[model samples]
Target chain A: MSLKPKTLVDFSFQALKANKLRSFLTMLGIIIGVASVILMIAIGQGAQAQVMSRVKALGSNVMMVLPGALGRFGAGSEGTAQSLTLEEASAVARLPYVANVAPVVRRAALVTHGANSWTTTITGTTPSITAISSTMSTVEGRFFSPADEKSAAPVAVLGQTVWQNLYPNGSDPVGTTITIKGVPFTVIGLLQSAGASMGGNNQDDFVYVPLKTAQIRLFGITFIGLMEVQAAGQKEVTPVINEVTALLHRLHGLPPGAPNDFTVRNLSQILSTAQDISGMLTLFLAGVAAISLIVGGIGIMNIMLVSVSERTREIGIRMAIGATQRDILNQFLTESIVLSLTGSFIGIVLGVGAAVAVSAFAHFPTPVSSLSIVAAVAFAIFVGVFFGYYPARRAANLNPADALSYE
Target chain B: MSAPLISCQELTKSYPLRGMEIKALNGVDLAIEDGEMTAIMGASGSGKSTLMNVIGCMDRPTGGRYLLDGVDVMSLTKDELAHLRNRKIGFVFQRYNLLPRMSALQNVLLPLVYAGVNAGRAANRALAALEMVGLAALAGNQPNQMSGGQQQRVSIARALINDPQVILADEPTGALDTVSSAEVMTILKELHQTRGVTLVIVTHEADIAAYCERMITMRDGRITGDSIIKGKRGA
Candidate 1:
């Protein structure tokens, strides 16, 4: 005679209830393991999403040509070197497959509007910067016109962060005058807010002026800082890069096989590189967390082994009454599965709660995927069955006569 | 005329202990017809408990030709033997082997659980068995809360739950006081008289053995005597 499945499960619950402390202690390992798994994955995915948003803000099918070679960490310190020129930017812009070019020269300066003053990056670029940066747009008034750039006009555009800092009263600064390094320029527009980039730099914290105005009036510098180049289409990015590289090589008079003075970095390449690093980090964290689960499984096995020996006489009594080896095995197996699944359920709740708390307090984007939850639960069951088998088998294999006679 | 309810021919059981083969049972041949109440008396290691275990289907004999209800016990697999034990043989231990965590009623219904009985009917039958043993009022109490006699009665009710043909009691009253022992013995005798259940009790106590009609004496690993007490026959 075999027991019904429902009866077996009931028996398991009763047995677990007999020793509450030991059961919870055994489940603690699993709880910690599951919680960390979910938390680590959430953090990893959040960082990845942050990187993706930064790439989106930087626009697509684009590349940046900066002075000097790319450094080990990122953009080289030689960025301030006067190597790139407006003529070189125009030359690259005329290349086939190149769509728009925005030559940029930037410097941090203290800008004042009325009594309010703020220190922010002052960027000087042509009107084509609006076409090159997909996120850049005027939220008030208008961007500086091509005619303003040609005449080196003393008109300025305020980024959202700069506008808020310089005009804390929220009054329109479109017709107001702002002084940058003691030079007065009329505020002609305000750019929409773009938040922060992957490098944690404020994207909306700059004041824009005409390229010629900054070159001739503000900084007295003749060379441009960098060039933002956009491809005609997604498929033309590589061709555009190759053409730009050749054109720059000829313009710089660099011999063939000589490393060029400028660094041409593809935006998508940086995006994929960021994604790879974060993905590896997620896997590494998960691997460490999985080890804890296995450790938890081992803890279960240890406790179950103790339980089996402790219940030898009880097992004998059941056997004498009519329970078969399979029944005994199933009873213990069910107990362990219940233990792990209960732990996992609590872990899921705790993990999700912790994710929300981190997002709320730390301002990190942590989207707990349903897939991770599913995977954690499935893995917990596997751990329960895998580690619970040996002890259950030992219990099932006991000789009834000897077991009954055991003290 | 018909085959005995339990039959044993040349049954032997041995185990290797410390590089020596120790014989627990040696070449014992016995039979008990349906409705027979018999007692086996022996000192420690006299093979009576071994014979009881063999008959209870809790242990297999190293060599034997045995039958319970005309089915060859020696040929049955482990699971089939368990099923046979559930269907035909019941066991009552000296320590009143009721699970400590379960209530008295749950203890009584243990065999029916393995017998695949439905819960509602099983509970009713368990209460009925408890009532017969006069412990129905204490059905919800765990074994630790009950007296020795009450615990033994609960175990007896457990043994009777499946309505098996034979009941094997090994030192069933060894752990009880004189009053509790008498109470247990009276219950067993009443069940045997009223239901015609075959009863096999293994005890060293002479008074306990006197409750049975037939008594068998064992020495070492073999039976020495088998006889019906004249006055106690069918008493």
Candidate 2:
């Protein structure tokens, strides 16, 4: 006869209570394993979101063509292999559907005014940078003009942070002279502070100079690092990218099917690629952490087997009183499931608590996804049912007469 | 006339010892009338316990046609046998075997729980059984908290809670003192005569067997003697 659910549950609870310490030890493994898995996934998701947000902060509908044949390794590694010249940047600017293009040349240089000296990034670009990049805007004075860029004038725009550091008294530094690598340049404008991006990079820690002055006066280099192109509209980005790729391919004289000498990537594509990699990495780590749960399940099976043997006489008594094999099986199986579910409840609370703790104390962004919580709970139930089956079967298969005789 | 409540024809039970087999019950036949209190007495290993186990439906005979209440028990499935044991048979073990962690009330309610009785009626019936055994005051006590006699009474209460047609007691007084043993024997006799329930007791003590209506003796897996108690105890 089928035993009542309430009876089986109560019996299981009482049995577990009889061996309190052993039951707790059996549940500990599952708690630790599930908690670790959840924490790792939460951290991974947090990092991915941080990266995506930083990428979005760069600009919209803007694409970069780095001067190399982008390979399987990464875009950063490709930059050392190739460098774009001003000629190539100008050639791309003439393409249709392109709203504006800025050829960027960057270098780390020591800048000094009075007795104060600081190491800061110096970027050489044109006035079109203000139009092409969403992050660039002036709060004081105005940006250098196209004529100033063409005339190779030694002019500059001080970043908000560099300006503040140099003029801590809050004096206006616009139109003041700052030495770049021992060369004097006039600061024609002041940029609004953009603070730090999600990557922890200080955005307002640089100075902008004319492309010609930076190339000829600061550091003698004919090639630029990369070029940024902004499309006229959101719909124009694909056509602009196609035109640039075709233009660069012809300029480098590459045949069809041959790899291009340069790589063009849009902002959204980079964001999604970053997301995919991080997502894959999270799953991989979560999968590894899930192994501990399996180990915990094995521990449960071991304990349950020992418990069955220890309670052989009890089983015999219950059987003598008309407990069917299925009844015994149900009771033991219910005990195991109850064990894991208890562990699961505690693990979920701990996992989320750890996630929130990390976010609060460690200054990381951790978003606790409800889907993961549900999945973890479901997995705990699955573990219980899976591991509880074997020992329960062993108990059910025992002979009542022999069990009665067991010491 | 109604058939006997229990009838076994040529019942045989054997177990393998090493390579050869040891017969525990050797083609023994027995019949038990309804409302009759019978005692099966024998030395250890003489098959009295095995006989009781078979009659209690805790084991099946290897070769026999055993009938209980005119139904073939040998033809029943394992679950059917369990149901029959729950509904038609109650067992009181020598050790009392009350789950030590449970109170007397919970222990007594066990059979009803297995019988799928609802909470309210099961609890009420368990209390009534405890009251019948005169242990209603000790119903809240665990087995360890009670004396041997009290524990035995609680087990008897458990056996009676299901209101089964047959009560099987295997050395019920074996673990008790003289006073406790006499009290248990009195309860069993009262249950038999007052309730008209069939009672089967397995014991080696002749004094305990004297309270029954009939006595059957076994020797080396075979029945050697059977006699009706014409002058029953206390009569």
Candidate 3:
């Protein structure tokens, strides 16, 4: 019938409307499949974005030297616990690319202020801690001076989380005395809230004290936990790591071919690893969703076969009038494509709605991308053509006389 | 004087039944001139319908040569055959095979659409065809909404929309009552006289055969009789 694409599409719409329920039922599978794929992609993108923000919060030029054989999972400290003492921290600060270093000693402790008591992590470090860590900034009063650290003074800095938990009424905690494990330390400063990290830990849920006071008076531990190192620039982190590794190897007297005792994890490496993980997650989910879409395509094929069988006489009539085999193929293919494209459009709306609902109600971020939407629509068209071809060919190949005479 | 509009030399069609060959048309040799209204009359199983199908390009002859307007029918490709059918020949079925959902005007426009006529001009052409069939006022009526006679008229309009050289009808009034059949026959006669369209009708009724200028009778898949009528009944 001259194979006019638009006219065939119009005919297809009319045919689909002739059996509205069947058309809608055929579209249901595609709707669900597309919606699920879109939702999964949105979740994956949101997680990647959150991870990037969290890593950026740790500062781009910073590296943490943990005192143990820390694996990717962050829990491989079963062997002899490696320690990054203050001496080693100073040794790292002597490296060529080193800018600042802070040797930290952390332990969970119960603190009391008047009648209020709360359990939170207590950090012991030097004034360089503020310089090396991007997450910390004094909003009230001031950080304890290096003089305070040298004198082993009983001065403390309260994190915003600890202040909120202890005070709760917005009362100023500066100049107030708080006892840490029976040792009274007067609050000298307040640290700004840094929110949660990618690992979902509150960065502000801690108090800072002098390293010597924490070591000699509070916990009685001489060893520091870790060293926070900042390079002079972003490009200097790798060189600083190499220098620190060599210096530590020499200090520990490790001979050649000996495995290093500590792990140096840089922010960029972790960020890239996180992106790969999330990207794979998105791909896996999309693959699973595509399987369902294939199944949906099969559903369309089955119904199209049935439609062709039911309309055998109609096909014969069209052939008798003037329609060529290609014309018949185009007509049925157009019908199937119209079905899937319409289903995909509706599915997009439903998918976006579902994603937004999840984000709002569950407080999880979901980012909807235009690329995914466009991909979904293109996939739907492919499914229609891939699955619709066989049935359409069958219809077009029918003998006109037999079809016309068919009951 | 010139080549006939339709010519067949020893045309044959066969079907396989239980590993045995059943010949629907053993051999058919006939010539139909342009502007002639002819009727092929035979009882059931006489292959009259088979000849109509072959002539309408709805089926191909198994063996022999068929020429429609000097063009070799057997040599045309499927798409070319479809184009020939769209441009040179039209058919009217017994059951008035109008698409059940479409209105009469849309049914008439079907051929024009298949012929690649422009959209704006198709409606006017279809309306003219409907007027020719005296169904112009019923242009918006669907097939099911109209009576059997009106549906057949709509189909006739559809066949006429392309203004083909030949119009083929297979027991065109078989499903209609007496009055409706007479009305349909009158329209066919008027079309043949005024438009000079070559008409080929397949029928078993002698009364229906009496309306045409020539009568060709078939029996046992071969022509039994061919005669020119001195006085056609309808005109």
**The candidate that achieves the highest DockQ relative to the unseen native structure:** 1
Best candidate, lDDT: 1
For each candidate, report its DockQ versus the true two-chain complex: 0.61, 0.54, 0.54
Give the Å shift of residue A24 in candidate 1. Answer: 1.3
Candidate 3 lDDT by residue in tens digits, A20-79:
999999999899889988999999888888888878777878887876665677633422
Question: Model 2 residue B207 lDDT?
Answer: 96
Question: Tens digits of per-residue lDDT for model 3 on B72-135?
Answer: 9999998888888888888899998888788899888987788788888999999999998888
Candidate 1 TM-score for chain A: 0.81
Q: Among these predicted structures, which one has the highest TM-score?
A: 2
Per-candidate chain B TM: 0.97, 0.97, 0.97
The single-chain TM-score for chain B of candidate 1 is 0.97
- Interface C-alpha RMSD after superposing true interface residues, each candidate, one decimal: 1.1, 1.3, 1.5
lDDT of 2 by residue, B1-235 (tens): 4799999899999999999999999988899888889999999999999988888888889997899999999998877887888889988889988887999999999878888888899989999999999999888999999999999999998888888899999999999999999999999889988999999999999999999889999998889998898534333
Q: List the residue pairs that clash in candidate 2.
A: none
lDDT of 2: 0.87
Q: Candidate 1 vs candidate 3: which has greater TM-score?
A: 3
lDDT of 1 by residue, B1-235 (tens): 7899999999999999999999999999999889888999999999999899899999999997999889998888888877887888889999989998899999898888888888899999999999999999999999899999999999999999899999999999999999999999999999998998999999999999999989999987898999897534343
Name model 2 segments beyond 4 Å from true: A68-97, A106-123, A130-145, A154-209, A217-225, A233-235, A247-260, B18-20, B231-235
**Candidate 2 chain B weakest ten by summed lDDT:** B226-235
